[model samples]
Target chain A: MTDDDLDLDLDLGPETPPVTPRARPTTREAPKSGVPSAKVMAERKPGVLSRVGSSVSGQLSHISRPNWSFRNFLIVLAVLVSLVVLAENWAAVRISFLGLRLELPKALAFLLNIILGGALTWFWLRRGVAAREE
Target chain B: MADPGGAWHRLLSLLQAISQRGLWATVPFALLVNSSITVLTLTIEPDGSAHRQISVVAAPYFRDQVPGWTRDVRADADWDMAWAVNREDDFVYNRDARIAALPESGEAAALTISDVAQNPFSLYTTYRWHEVVGYSYLYDSDPAAAEATNKSLIYEITMPGTVTNATVTPATGSSTKTEGPKVVFELAASQGQQTIEVEASRLRWGYLLVLAYLAAYVIYCSACTLRHWLRIQPRKI
Candidate 1:
């Protein structure tokens, strides 16, 4: 009941730990500028338009990479030239063949040229895949 | 890293494989086959008979629509005929009122023609004409029915050489008669089939030319393909 007894009682619990203040949860500081918080950025989902834009950019980057060789370029060029020649003299070339008859509109013919050109270019460029396999 | 020279060598090797394996020749072979079929289809008998069809339609288009309609029809018809014939010169379209005089030459004549008009539905009616030469020539509007009605179709064709015998099969609901040098027939507006079998002596050299050209092309492609294959073969040790 005395002051000494009270101090002893308060101090006697050496083995038992004293109640300490709980540590505050660590958090990233908010950006000084008007930028959004990391939580908001993490929580926000990518929109459809943004996703499409990123996908297209990725494809374009893959396609535009400098992986083509001189011979591949030459082959692609030759094929493209042939396609142009075919498109230009389509009627005459068609008539030369007795049974091969095809009549395509100008727009459709141009579209065909683009598709064939893209395909040939892709094939030639991707010959590296064959090299890797070998 | 890839061997820059190796890529070229591989390309050559691939091409060699294509030639040796006859992979690249598939397209040319297919073309040759198609050309052969076409040649057979267009062959003209010694009696100058061919498998051909002539159709006439009453184009229902105003002056403004006539050009577009005629162009579209002509393009379509030309594409269709190109499959069976070698030339488009045989098909003609008359834009004037004047009837073309028969050629003095003794050559076989087959022409599918269309007439031009300011207004097909107007009070003044315009006439369209077509000519075909074969043992049997079918005259119907079903082929061109989508373009216009053939209710008032009239055919005036002058067969080459002396006509031995001409007969119209299923002779019903159609008025057909022979004139001095031509046969005229009026077709019913409704959908139907009518065939005219004419026996006559005519000459056809276009078929021979087409066959020769196709044969030459096939031979050329085959020879080139074979030579390339042989040249690329590795020499024996």
Candidate 2:
């Protein structure tokens, strides 16, 4: 049945309900704000595209920031550069300088560079971590 | 109140993150260890064949028989000799072991000294002998009082035939011999053992180094493969 028809047939009491309106303070909670409030949701799962997008954006944010991660990136880059330098200057590295000349192979030269680079990396990283902790 | 499951998930994610970064440290270390092992392996293995055919001619030396009527002098000695060949001029030898010293008297034959030293400055020297086996012999006999004077001989080899390139049909046709220097030999039977000392240079060691490196690399690769397999096992399971 329609509400109006029900009301007309059963108008038994004049006292019903009272409604109030007032100007709220800043701290006071409003019933309907611009942002939707949390509700008992049915838990609609995120789609594949949404998940992928979120991950990609997170990675981008991490990469863009100049932080520890960036320093790590530079460290890797330096290592790569050193590797190239070792490869290109393989002959130079193999040859040792004294009063006379001594020649070794590219393998030995490459090994020396790796040892030096690894030791340096370890020392620098350890110190960096210690400083951060302090 | 919170879900216990959520905390487990976070911890697992953190562990994964740590492992991924940890791999960065381990990978390079593994590579270096593998490479070094490979170089060490190079030191242990033998290199491929180092063979060269070199023509050698040594200066003639005296061979003598003390008492003989018939004496023959011959400078044609067989030279089936071999020594080490080196790309680099570095000398590698067992110092404690006594090796017959090279000719120290007069200036060594240009070919012998140049070849031994691998002196680049002597690149233009015409003579290059790899092996030398040469000798000469003489016989002298005097008849007593009235007996006929017989058998006083000294022979020197001369005019060895030219080693010419000739074409010959295998079965159907006879091979033609072109005219060249006649092989001349005046024979005197003489018995004497003469030893001429020639320098055998230091053995080559580069090949050894290369071989060792190869063996080491192979071992390193095996280790790397093992490490990779071990690291992936947990993931697979």
Candidate 3:
């Protein structure tokens, strides 16, 4: 019933009449200021797709999605670059060491030098570990 | 909470790290234990027949006497580095006590099986893997070759013809060398023996016959084009 329709007068009332609350606060058990982080987490579950979607939507609010046809273009470009680099070093280079003639592609020679250096370093390190353990 | 397997896992991780970073440190005579792997060499014949020679430490690098894989299974002679193959599963030898410096020498063995049914010449490619009977991890069915991680598992395959492509699956620090028909794939034993897929083809009668048909077809097409170019339209039907 509306408050205006509840107008009544009692004739003989010994004690104080019943007192009714006019209005109650709608928010209960909640802090007076803002929502808590824990409550926000409890309200929803976070998934991988949801996180990605949220990130995308936040940044590209009005931008359109990228085309799908060029998805593998970067991989193809990387392969092409590798092939070009290999081709660039394909010219035969000669080196004379210890009265022996060694001829190989520039790439191969560099690779061999790197391998030899790595082997030497590994051997030295192994020796050091052995001695240290002993 | 304490886990029983955690200790074992930690020990294994330490050993693995040591093996990768430096020389082996489990045994006292780690340096004496030769850092050599069991080399398996397969010489594929022109007529689709194949032979594999597997050589282990202190074992005879089985001198292939017969064209069909004849071997002397004698471990008495100090095995020089060569291909040694033991086709049978019952092939087991006594481990040399001097190598490991252990009180008692355990048993050592090797077994190799090839899928010759998929002939390279017929299929244009073939897949083969070595099931080197392993130890150390005895509880598990040691189907793969179990050796020192620092050492290499070498597979030298002499194909029938020039090898077009040779790739090892599950690459773990693997390297391949292709010299004409011979393809040598060296992989870390830690990764286990990987399947070797080789694509090779020999110049045979079947290929020559197919090429002859292609050549005729090309010539006929070109000749027709030439006739049309000359405006010789007399022949109909």
Candidate 4:
């Protein structure tokens, strides 16, 4: 009642608990490969090709990592092939066989092959993933 | 149910792990099968009513070169005649008829048979021995069918042959005329060859196409199985 003069002794007849120190927010150390920060390099100067090369190499290294999946490779292959086919702009390309021939548009052929590849990939994934999951 | 995301990742992993040989094999295999399919559909004349469905036995009989037959056309080397008959009377009953010898000069090929079928319109008839081979008597029995334009009928194997170069005359009576034997028209090696020899053989073009596809599919299946087999082996590298 009087600034805890009388109550302090009454409430705490025993030892008082020590106050706990507040923890600091921890910061993570930068990775060793940091030659120069991207912002600093951009501000300093960056050649067009060098920038492109670095970006591309970064992607390539990422893809080449051991944990990369086969399905991703197939999808990339399909995409690249489809793009090339579309860019060629051929109409009704013909393939000949023993006294026979069929013509199909380039885009149609690429799309069809992609669909087939995707379906096969999906089937393979189902079996392997399901077993591993189990 | 556990996670589709995990399943897809596993699949991508499998695809990337496929061997280089497996990848290489797919290229040629696809090329072969796809090309063969294209050729087969594009070449063969679609089956039509004008197609003379003579039994293989009857086909030889009608050709008049049947060995030891009384009416052996081969033996009558000098015989050159032309005759026409109606469908119900001649073609239905008398399977064999004498056709004139092909003219020796002025043209390289002869017209043999011309039959027309219009539904998706296919005409499957042969030109043999210097004549166009078709349903010989149909023209007489079915005059209205004759007017049908697409009716399959063998009109005549012309005496003088037709000459076809790079320039083709479409719908022209004389330009695309089917000549006697294919030997006379193109493959000179076939000239003077016996009908039996030709009958026993297959078209080289068609045969080659089929074999290509067969080989491709076989390799593809083999490669597919081999990949699985190789996976079981202990890593050597």
Candidate 5:
């Protein structure tokens, strides 16, 4: 049908729905503690110490929080203590492994075990994040 | 499930405490247990009153005694009845043999045993004295300190006379060595038996015989010295 042939039924037929205004979220005030804006902050990589501290903290919070599972908490703690023990035994000695004997410092062993602790820490973090999601 | 006071539960609790408190949590226990190692040394006197010297490893048993000195040392002190009576001398610290330096430290202290009942405790009798020289403080005469300890104890007892016989109750892994008047009974930690019993007797005449022999040897040496001096002297002088 042509535009001129169509009847003008703006008021005669059913009422036309009004268009909803576009809503804009208001800007939040700057935090008093001087926290950087999430969008503005650079996505720089965390140092080794920072990553280790975060993992340890996450594992401990899992231990101390009221709803923490005992087995996981204990496993995490065991990982932490083993790491510390490895660090403390930073001395050179003859280490026999699978019939092959070699001399190495315990600190080297500690460096090798650090990754193991980090892995456990990551597991705890993933589990915690999953629980939170649930 | 393990009991709350059971070893497993206790270990879990300790781990929990360490997790809560960090590394500093262990420092107090180490300082209290490892630093003040208690060694009981008992030497029988001529009059038969056992002379006791309780020596303790220095405050820095694990660490350096001085700034640069790393030798493990136990400091000895004269016995004071007042100190023990006040309960200031009942510390239960003992050397952990696992610490490699302990065996080489050469810190052997003599602890006195007053538990032998004086009534039947005569040197003339050939009977055995089953002294409970472990942590049982029954013979310590301090009725208030009646707790049993689990630490390994080394008993270095000197008999006033010759040892007729010597034995340790837990003879397995336990060493009992007698050198004349002195008897050394070492109870290792792995033995797990807290009670270490020793059998000792005195030879009243042996002391006199030793003293007489020493005197005769001294006299003979003096006579030889005099003869040599006379022979070396100038005749005109």
Candidate 6:
């Protein structure tokens, strides 16, 4: 219970040094091939026109190689025939439709063609995805 | 899940499934519907002629001076009456009718009847009169040229039935004569107003059959597509 006993009880381990923060890396390591790092390239914004052009080109590339099938052929034939008939009897057909009459026959016909073609394309894509899964 | 873009994606996928299952059936339906509409809109025949009557007042010089005044009265039954007056005129004096822009004046005029359906035997009549300024040198020397040059009016009428008692006013030529389906009347030295009359018969039973068949086919194909689409199971996300 003397001073020596008190010092022995209080003693724990050897004094540890104060920890210092690690220094920030001064310069980024150069890319091995001399190309900009992915982080740096991604940080740069693309021009509006270039972005739009890339997206359009991507869609066109996707559409260029449609899977050929009987259903696709029939859909294409039906669309072509509808377009031809619309072209030949534009005046008569324009007047014939009740409430859906349009001023520009070619425009209306093209709109209809787009809707039909889009629907068919969607169907083809869905079927292809399903078949691949199976 | 409540986002608008998510909802749009779901709706699009649903449509995709429906269309994929029913595309085969829908193709024939589309073809039938388009063909039916084309046939109904363009080729359906009318019950009667458009019946356009046009009278051109003869100029003072042309009143009685033209010897063969009625020689150019051409009657074409096969010609489309709707486009009769719109056609190009063959004669120089009759060319005025062919111009659509110029106002109705001088030797030409036109009458149009809209919404009138086309017919197979619709009669188209054009009255053109040319002056007979004596006979040419070859015909001047021959007496037959004088007889031939004498003012003559010709009526060429076409109809299915036999043209019985067909006649023209101030008649001085041969009686009503039948040539196949046409009735021709030649009159000598005529002046003033003249009238020609004949009866026609038309066949009218095939159109209904065609329309009915088209309707039935469209309905059948549409029903099949609908049934197939309804039976399809919704795709799992």
Candidates ranked, most accurate by lDDT first:
3, 5, 1, 6, 4, 2
The worst-scoring run of ten residues by lDDT in candidate 3 chain A lies at: A36-45
Q: Indicate the docking level reached by candidate 4.
A: incorrect
Alpha carbon lDDT of each predicted model: 0.38, 0.30, 0.46, 0.32, 0.44, 0.36
Sort order, TM-score high to low: 3, 5, 6, 1, 4, 2
Cα deviation at A34, candidate 3, in Å, is 99
**Residue A126 of candidate 4: its Cα lDDT?**
99
Worst 10 residues of 3 chain B by lDDT: B96-105
Better of 3 and 4 by lDDT: 3
**On residues B9-35, what C-alpha lDDT tens digit does candidate 3 reach at each position?**
545634443343222111111111232
Give the higher-TM-score candidate: 4 or 6. 6
Worst ten-residue run, lDDT, model 6 chain A?
A87-96
Across B105-164, the per-residue lDDT of candidate 6 in tens digits comes to: 221211221121434333332211111111111111333432454534333444433333
User: If scored against the real structure, what TM-score would every candidate get?
Assistant: 0.22, 0.17, 0.28, 0.17, 0.27, 0.22
Q: Which candidate is the best by lDDT?
A: 3
Q: Candidate 1, after superposition: displacement of residue B99 in Å?
A: 19
Model 3's CAPRI class is: incorrect
* Candidate 4 residue-wise lDDT, B122-189, digit = tens: 22323222221111111122323333332221122121122222122122221233334221111111
Residues B56-163 of candidate 2 have per-residue lDDT tens digits of 111111011100100111111111222322224321110011111222233211123332235433322122112121112111221121013211112111111231
Q: Top TM-score: which candidate number?
A: 3
In angstroms, the error of model 2 at B220 is 2.3
Summing lDDT over every window of 10 consecutive residues in candidate 5 chain B, give the lowest-scoring window: B96-105
**What does the lDDT read for residue A57 in candidate 1?**
91
- Going through the candidates in order, their DockQ values are 0.01, 0.01, 0.00, 0.01, 0.00, 0.01
lDDT of 2 by residue, A1-134 (tens): 99998898788657667876743334334357566344433346679998899999998887755443445645755665555444433332113255444445454666877899999999999999999999
